[model samples]
Target: MKLISLLFIILLRFDGTTASLVKESSDKNTVYVCGSGKGKRYHLNENCRGLKSCSAKTIKTTREQAQKEGKTLCGWED
Candidate 1:
């Protein structure tokens, strides 16, 4: 089972699909985002510069929840 998982990961990397894998894995990780209607980004760190401009309340949630709300990764996250 472990070998299969490893092979799947390797194949995902070879095909440049690691982003999906990473996202899938990080779905459960805590992320921060603005709670306003205009909010459209998720930050791995609560103090990310991207959240500085947010006038609404900052909320912490799972990355998956943020994505479900149409939020993308904050530009500053890179």
Candidate 2:
């Protein structure tokens, strides 16, 4: 019984931590990218000047996903 209670407390703490992390990640996860372009940078703003030369569609994606696809932050990004 004591072990079960301890496990429950641990699970609650983990869940709270995970929730906070997810919230923080979500706040900054969304970023803009160019689809099918020679450029390999992600922009924080859709209207960034760097995006002006994009030869493809502007896409919204997670920052992590963009990095996974070999993209880095745009030089024009703040």
Candidate 3:
């Protein structure tokens, strides 16, 4: 039917869009955070000076997720 063909076209478009999004996200570099802080800070470099004295575990996360969680760039890296 025409409706079925239209639905298939829409599904293909959605799949292509999803694939592009995944590729873009994966192309970005990963960020890190020192869990010792208030979780409001993120660093592009794991060895940033600001993280030198981290007393807790370090976590790896994406920049977008960090921003959503209200994390700011570390002064040492900014």
Question: For model 3, how does the per-residue alpha-carbon lDDT over 7-30 read when each residue is reduced to its tens digit?
Answer: 866676579875554544465667
Tens digits of per-residue lDDT, candidate 1, 7-74, equal 87777776656656565556658888987868888988777899999999999899888899998999
lDDT of each: 0.82, 0.80, 0.76
Query: Which of candidates 1 and 3 is the stronger one according to lDDT?
Result: 1
Please give the range of 10 consecutive residues that has the lowest summed lDDT in model 1. 19-28
Best candidate according to lDDT: 1
Higher-TM-score candidate of 1 and 3: 1
lDDT of 1 at 22: 63
Q: Least accurate stretch of 10 residues (summed lDDT) in model 2?
A: 17-26
Error of 1 at 37 (Å): 2.4
Tally clashes: model 2.
0
What count of clashes does model 3 give? 0
TM-score of each: 0.61, 0.61, 0.57
- Tens digits of per-residue lDDT for model 2 on 1-78? 999988866676579875554544457878889887566899877778989988889998899999998989999886
The most accurate candidate by TM-score is 1
